[model samples]
Target chain A: MTRIINRQPAPLGRLVLATLPFILLALVYLLASDARLAENPSDKLLPSMQSFVEAINRMAFEPSRRTGEYLLWVDTWASIKRLFTGVGISAAIALLIGVANGMIPYARAPLSPLVRALSLVPPMAILPILFIVFGLGELSKVMLIIIGITPIMIRDLQLRTDALPEEQLIKAQTLGANSWQLILRVVLPQLLPRLIEAVRLTLGSAWLFLIAAEAIASTEGLGYRIFLVRRYLSMDVILPYVLWITLLAFITDYLLQLLSKKAYPWYHAQLGEK
Target chain B: MSEIPSIQPIIEARQLWKEYGEQVVLERINLKVMPGEFVSIVGASGCGKTTFLNLLLGTQQATRGELLLDGQALDPEPSPERGIVFQKYSVFPHMTALENVMLADEFAQSALFGRVWGSARKALGKKAMAMLERVGLGHAASRYPSELSGGMQQRLAIAQALMKQPRILLLDEPFGALDPGIRKDMHGLIQQLWQEQQLTIFMITHDLQEGFKLGSRLWVFDKVRHDPQQPERFGAQVTFDLPLASEGAKQAAAEQLQQVSNPTTISKEQQHDLSNAV
Candidate 1:
């Protein structure tokens, strides 16, 4: 069995470095907030000091409330279940269409120009058109997200497939491997690393579109909740939801990196570095 | 050696012609190779020796002639029946030595086994191990091609070709990449393997010494033709069938083998005296 080592661990020095910036920012904010706290604070410093403190606090502790309070506690089990099912269905559909279109030459040739043109039209630009067609429903939001992500995913997948080594393909041909066999045995193994990279990138694009999708046409979801808070200028709730989205994106990207490393160890070995 | 089988010729090329955009590489080349017969084609750099090997391996198609294998029309497709070991040691670098040998077995059984990993895998693994042992690479089976020396890599390539159970082995300068000492060892290993398997081998090399050491019958491609009417001709083809005895005789004969470096030097007094003495 191969021994996997933990590359990063928390030590006193790391802990100090992590907290140093925040600590200095807090001190500056406290001193400017009041003349008594600093020995001398002018009227011009008061408003700026209050805003800085609010931003700092918002950044520091907002995520725990979003994940622990809003996502896990208030939303309950049903809401989390719906989020996963919706995302899973969207990802599966996008992957199937992307991979199929990417692999077929004629399909890619005819559709690539249209897809490139569509990608330039921002997800938000289609909101009014989508709402007029599908109404302000869950389907409209999911459709919007899918349409926004499919083109990017397809482009990435196509580039990955095209970038495969010619020698491997020729070897497969000389070995008497047919089309399907070539794809399954030779192409797929070589494409795994790039495909995983595409997935990570597309996943980020999906999240960016998620907020737009929900803000325009949806009654529920983390994005909808954040939009509802924005109406009242409730920075606390808005900050927390944004924090949740960022954390989820980081976790998903990290998971994909780990999975790619495990599934395509040969690629990493070829790179001659971890 | 084992009993010489009365089987038909393994490879036969008749009036074979290969050309690249009006430059005729080879023309009207006819040859037949019997089982267990070791033949070496020695020629200058552009004499189409490699092209001939490629034709036999089915990697290259003849421009205007017929090539047959055991009385059947040669298929313009690569198969395990004709294994090729190239000068570059064309073994897959990512694969271990054992895996390279096992690739042939895998390809042979793929049709019937349908990629199932059971008896076919076990049998191929055993055969690969035995082949590696024969090539003196049993201990290095787990090592990648890059980790092995040049001679070891060539040995592994030979073993892989042999593991395919090819009817005839085509080697295009298999030991041309090795040093002189390593080349001699590889020649010995090739001779031993051919003797043990009774493999019909056709090798192409510019090294006259290697050809003489390994080939049972040596063929030289000279541009000067021997015509009765003309006392001297600029271009002709000369074929020498030297007898192989002990190492000393083989070495001496190899030294006497003339190269086609200069077409005009064909009638050199030294060559005339050597030819007359032989």
Candidate 2:
């Protein structure tokens, strides 16, 4: 009986050694910046730090205000709620349309050229059209996000579906699988890994589009807050929102990858080997 | 082998003709495989052995012949009556070994949903597990195909094909990718499965030794030319049939098998046949 053990993990010492260059660069940067800060302590550094802290505190605690003379502060909960609703609806629609298009060859073949053409058209190019059709409401914003992300999702699904191993398809056909069965059972399972990857890519693209969508006639969302602060040249307020969005993207991408590994362990093992 | 008498031919191909474009692969090929019979089709590459298996499995259409299953003409539609295992990795890579086999069983019982309830799914899991055990892969049942070694993956493929309780099993070079030792083991497993399930198997192999070891009857295709003496014979085609049982049959079979196993052994007769096979 042959037992295959996993390859040994790299030693901790060697792992630390591998990070030496990045660690050294960070140390150099910290030392150089620290010297400048120490030499010019009277350059209103305390007030700048105080302002940064106040912006974080404000975004975390106080909710945003829409009208004038009412000091508005964006809260974390509102930002999260807007992100969840916007990304959730956009991803769901994109995934459904992408998967449906991928499964039907007739649809994919005729629609692929149109999709390719549409993908080339920037989301911003059709903002005016969307604004006129759906108005400057949440529908337009969500539609913009869908437009930005759908092409990528469709292309990914199409490529993954096409890249399925010929032998597996033949085997499924020989096993009495109909087209639907083949797609759901054999093809979809094989597409799971790529679909997860697509989700990550789409998530990032959705976030990118979210900011733009929010900047355009949007009342809610981190994007709107960032845009509003940008008008005032209040970099402090904008910086926190940027950091929050970055953190949110990182967390969502990480969660998606984690789910992918759990759902398709073989993908993780193969990737881990590489 | 007393149970053999109770078994009947499950797969019958009558005058099967398969052509692709201008090239005819199998012409007027007739074969009857009895239940529990381990029939191996041995030929050089491009002799249409795989095509014959496809026809039997109903995955392909015969150009001008009829294929019958248990006295009925095989439906062009796919059915659970025939299961096929391929030479390459056909097991769904995203699925575990058990899942792969279970999926086949589920597909087979898709119509019995009202009567079976969730029992069918449970039974499928149990059956898949039993199949894994039979193939000596019970411990690796949870492992995905890509996680398994090449030989193990092929074994999983075999299990998946057989899990459907198919009346006839079609194997196209099932062990063609395995090493000699693993191939021998897989052959033993296949033979055991055939006996246990009373399965009618039509296996295609380029390996002469595999044909000898597993095939109850070996079908060989010899190339024929209209003008044998012509320096460049133009009208050439394959004439395939079961090898004749003669005094020199065993020796000739071994020689041909050797040529197939080792291409460098390319004897003059084999080369002549190969040239005419085109």
Candidate 3:
């Protein structure tokens, strides 16, 4: 007679428990969609699974009438290019500035205050300014994502570097490491995995900024397509696009986590014990 | 103090004092340490035993006097000439035990890269492996510090420190976190390494028995004067300096240390006499 609080589920039971909410939500959506469509066949909201599947098929497999290109693939590639470019630049800048800020007082004294202040400012508030400065091109959209996430990632990495045990630094110095060597060898290797983790954490916000920028000004992108179709109440296309973006984010996060675990097994091992 | 040997002292501290603003931590510490002497220091917590180790390690500068290494002023920064092992976090968690040992040579040979490659890396790996075998962590060479047990990690730390071939080794309670059984094994390993390397060692310990069992010389740090109003006004000094080269001297010093440490074992009158004698 185990108490409910103390009751434990077996592996199969756990799997069923994990998917229960999603299944329930899907069932409710199907019932509501059926009811709406029965009353009004042309209902735009909560499209049926059949309409969703047809919309996905047209977007993914068929060629567009105007451009003769699969619009879905084109939009995905465009968005991914901007996302990765912005995130890549952010990662490089965060690594260099963050490690410097953590290890050197001189580096920290000037930049840390500036980074802290920048992180406090709402990144979305400056979207117009970024668009004005960088123009309504790819640069502005990429800049938005970079500006949104770079400061946060830098602050995260700096704290991680600062949190490194003082003993390791001393031990490295005693082992004849110069300041540069200390940063390059002892500090950089350890902070790289942390940078990956920080990037993973910030990917969601990066997507938000990217989509906002594209929705405002873009020729063709997932966000642009979704926003363009919103006028006609194309829930089928828009809902699938949203789900696609979510799937992409999940896959990217999973890959980065796998990279961290594989490339830096010692980091994960250390985490497990400490 | 015993008579100074004719051989040139490897390290000499002349009126060393460390003060933090108005507070004193260590005061008037003067000593002449010959080469290859295993000096074990024991004191109550916050008596500046670790501070003395830091001064010797060149991580902390003395406020008032000179700390000479090889008859020259010791550098204000740590270098390969002096190696140190802290109680914990001494080993790099990101590195395998073998790579940790090889790090010293890598830093020395490749100043810019902090690593060697190809043939040079292979050769260094072999040398590091030999050192690992000496410390008895050869089998766990590929294991990360976290994967190894505490005793093995400390052995890895010792092996890493020895890679630089330092003349002096500073250990700040390196075995404090270890279980007693594991600690004994570490002691044997350290003693073997010390003797084999002819290393001049300075170890700080809270365990009096460990201090007596290991060192050729024992240093007891205690305050000569205490202020009832302000404890920070007075600083600790080497109150008891005993050379344990002879068995009789070791036994007598152990008894004295026991009495000083355990006040319940002695009457108040005897305790008063002991403090005055110190």
Candidate 4:
């Protein structure tokens, strides 16, 4: 059999292709909401798009009556701050240990097994332990993301570092790089794009851990709001909040992909599929 | 003329035997390579060619005996004193050709960030560009190694290796992966660089023609004392060391012809001779 495929699609074609699925999904939701509302005008399980828009506008655009501030925006800031802080620290630690352990055999021999074993222990299972240890503050929540995601990130990066050509390492050494210089110059630059990819992969689990912690106990977050409004059957607010979270995650992933391509053009070029 | 410095051996390996407790890999390998001499080591697969190369590169420690670079005992770690070009995957794939060439200069100035500022960066860039142009990669300075063709990648590898101005350059079948046309071009480039740089080179190659064409000295590695009863008793050794400067071409031609006729005959001959002597 023969095949014909275009590697580069036109912008309009791409745009259509990207939005077609979303458009269909929106249609399904709208139809489902209409049927539910026709049966029961006050059904909270399937709220109309008007209600969704109104709920989001009230939460995002208008100041809350109690707090005198936009709750949605506030939640965005707080949640993102916590998420990025934990992820940033995790990436740094993963890079440090991953490069060292990957490049040096002695470091790898003992540490790799421990990292692999710990990554297996479910982070949610340790959530209560972390809460007890760190208390019901930002510390515990952030600790969840770190402990849940860092070991896997470290392992991901360590494997990348290990897969690095021995020729490159030897070449750097021959160019007068000591171990420190080798890691810093040759290995680190190469690892950055991979680190971005690793972070991207762990973002889902990171968010899962974050939401789990927030749902269990937290004053304010996307998860806290969704679970809070769940008691009152506020489907309008919950649905909108869920969509907003999805949007934020999408934007983050896009930005990271953009960063990797921009900062490391060589990597993108080699990937063969933008 | 700089007083025509009498032949000084830049690299010396004395009875360098490498082995595990149960297996002997290389045994009693003795050789001296002079400065500015292109020496080629030829052998069949599994004949300790890479092992000998690694021993010289300091990646592998000989189980016994010693290796000296410039009359000093060579430390068993890779250093700037020796540069190497492999068959493939030599250049840093993540960097542009120019960046790859300037890596050593950057490390020399600042080991941490590799940020050369002001006129220094300009100077290094110029030097690196010159090397790239010398290797016929002037237009490919910004291309990644993956983007370059196999021949171009080999050229980039050579350029990167020459960045440090090492005393000796090691090439482990650098052109084996290239097409014949490109290999011929690479041969010219290597010979030209060797002449211009006054470089001492130790190249490991399995191809007899390529070994004869690029190098001035030839060393053949093979297992000589192959006793089926005690197969691991003796490892590969330098069976023939022919200096191309003097009547060496004839010896290389003989070995090449012999290789073509029967690849295993040399090893068998050496084994028979060793057994008779024993």
**Maximum-TM-score candidate:** 3
lDDT of 1 by residue, B160-238 (tens): 7776577778888877778988887887898998898998888888665566667776766655443566433223233
DockQ of each: 0.11, 0.34, 0.87, 0.60
Model number with the top DockQ: 3
Off by over 4 Å in 3: A1-5, B1-6, B261-278
Ranking by lDDT: 3, 4, 2, 1
TM-score of chain A of each: 0.69, 0.76, 0.98, 0.93
TM-score per model for chain B alone?
0.80, 0.77, 0.91, 0.89
Clashing pairs in 2: none
- The candidate scoring highest on lDDT is 3
**CAPRI-style grade of the A/B interface in model 3:** high
Alpha-carbon local distance difference test for all models: 0.66, 0.69, 0.90, 0.86
Model 2, span B162-246: residue lDDT tens: 7667777888888878887888788888888877787777788776556666766667654443344652322112343434234
Give the residue spans of candidate 2 off by over 4 A. A1-51, A61-83, A93-102, A106-114, A270-274, B1-15, B28-36, B111-120, B226-240, B243-252, B255-278
Candidate 3 lDDT over B124-145, as tens digits, reads 9999999999999889999999
Worst 10 residues of 1 chain B by lDDT: B230-239
Q: On a 0 to 100 scale, what is the lDDT of residue A12 in model 4?
A: 100
What is candidate 2's lDDT per residue for A144-190, written digit by digit as tens?
A: 77788778777777777666666787777666677777777777666
Residues B1-278 of candidate 4: C-alpha lDDT, one tens digit per residue: 13434475789889899998988999998888878899988888888989989988889898999898877898779988899999877888788899899989999998667658889989999999999999999999988887899999999999988998888899999988889899999999999999999999999986666676677887888888898998888899988787666444645445444553335634555434323322
User: How many clashes does each candidate structure show, in the order listed?
Assistant: 6, 0, 0, 0
Estimate, for each residue in A1-274, the C-alpha lDDT of model 1 and write its tens digit: 5446755546987999899998998687556555453554433324344544565455443544544443423322323444444455655654455555656677667777877787688877887887889887766766666677766766666676666554344344444445565565545556667667776777766666666766665655677667775786655456555666787778878988999888766566656532
Q: How close is candidate 1 to the true structure, as a TM-score?
A: 0.64
Q: What share of the true interface contacts does each candidate keep?
A: 0.04, 0.53, 0.93, 0.78
Candidate 4, which segments miss by more than 4 Å at Cα? A1-24, B1-7, B111-115, B229-231, B246-248, B255-262, B265-278
